[model samples]
Target: MSDLPLDQVRTLLAVVDEQSFDRAAAVLHVTPSAVSQRVKALEQRLGRVLILRTKPVRLTGSGQVVVRFARQLTRLEEDTRAELGLVGAAEPVTLPIAVNADSLATWFLPALAAVPAVGSAPAVAFDLHSEDQDHTATLLREGLVMAAVTSAPNPVQGCTSARLGRMRYRAVASPAFVARWLTDRPLPEALPAAPAVLFGRKDELQDRFLRGLTRRGATGVRHFVPSSESFVDAVAAGLGWGMVPELQHRADELVDLAPDHPADVPLYWQQWKLDSPALATVAAAVVAAAATALRQ
Candidate 1:
């Protein structure tokens, strides 16, 4: 077995996490030269170029593997301390997680609140990274977060997954916009001619729904408002029509153009395989909340 130095591995992780050798050196209380030498030693021992030294350094594929190992090592160290009663009794459990923005606006906060209180332990604190359901798992793969709610069924390496449920979406627009733009015409003909709002350039949910309705894909006449709240607001302001989550629309004056035609996107929760009590508590709370809020 090739002996890998723990300090070198940790130094590599610090570089990736801080994204700068100088910053990592400050955190480690070592000179930047020492940090650089340690990473070089690690790369030599592993026989791979681990990091791409750029402004805000980036990990190569090999570096990602080492970074993941470093995170798992940290987690295991913490678990060992807790199991041996080495940590203070009232220490807070920090869980870093990735979730979609729509769920954050609707169900995720309540789920965190539902975690059962532990006796005298500091309240569980979450470091949440918000992204789309389709992309949240990338955070898990990079060891940036311990868990994620995603649209992917395939689990990330060293992770376990369970289906949460589906979030239903409906195509909606302001009544005024529809009257002016869609009245007295077939939906397929009118929809293509009208303006539209999108969550982002990558978002295809609205286009996919439109394709189902019109037997043709959505037009290029679109405005991209990336945030979930802003995208819905843009639709309500009649900037354009678009798909909005059912849960986010109740208080708005927006009208569903195709109430009978809604799209359901499946969601799943995936977490690291480590048996962390804090992770378990959060997972249970999220599952329970999803059961109540998402369509099963």
Candidate 2:
């Protein structure tokens, strides 16, 4: 442990986050060999392998622990500088947060913009990790972000959570597509027959909504568009029908398949329990914006 150097620990974290020794080296302005050597030395000292050398490399269980410590160390250093006024011209606090694509397209940006700029405190720059609401909390657990808007009510370790609001989604299609494919048949029967657009394989929201409405699951044919904006556009372009976030749907003239049965996914903001002024300000702004934009 005494033999382990902080530089080596930080280098390991950089590689894990950047997912490439070459990229980490570039960030550190060092040769890739240097980065590799540092990591290797750290592994030898710790007597535990830190990372899996794979594409978009993954951290080992022990690696996650070290990554968490590295993040904490970085935070502490920043806080100390701020307290000591060592950092000239209060630097903008960069808040890294995990959020779902639906929220990102809808209310999240406006909420971030609403955070008041403090004296010399740089404007908040958000580092957003876009993923499904149900899975956003996993980023927090891995110490990938300082905050998250997730579907999970239970907070991650060392984090606090508060309900943001619920995002309502409706199964929708273009008028032409509905007329051609649905033709007044019961949705469950017609949905399986019509082409559909899914956010991704993990997206069960549309399928779950269909099951509740028609007592059956989604169809086999689905065009995977991973992005929230593109998924809506795919439906609009008559490529396939999908569940569109109500917030995004408000401006569009898309035909709602089942007006009475919209899916409501509750969202929550979870952040580290640290009392950093920057984190607090951002949280307040996000909560305030969510209250107005999302359905309670």
Number of the predicted model whose lDDT against the real structure is largest: 1
- Candidate 2 lDDT tens digits, 142-184: 8788899999999998899999989999889998888889988
Error of 2 at 20 (Å): 1.1
List all candidate RMSDs to the true structure.
Answer: 2.3, 2.3
**Alpha carbon lDDT of each predicted model:** 0.85, 0.84
lDDT of 1 by residue, 1-296 (tens): 22679999999888877889999999999999999999999999989999999988877878877887787777677666766777675765677799988899889899998785532233466889988888999888977788999999999989999999999998889988989898989888889778999888778788789778888876648898989888888988889898889888854589888878999999999999986766777888899999999999
lDDT of 2 at 60: 84
Number of residue pairs clashing in candidate 2, backbone atoms closer than 3 angstroms, sequence gap of 3 or more or interchain: 1
lDDT at residue 131 of model 1 (Cα atoms):
87
Runs of candidate 1 with Cα error greater than 4 angstroms are 89-91, 116-123
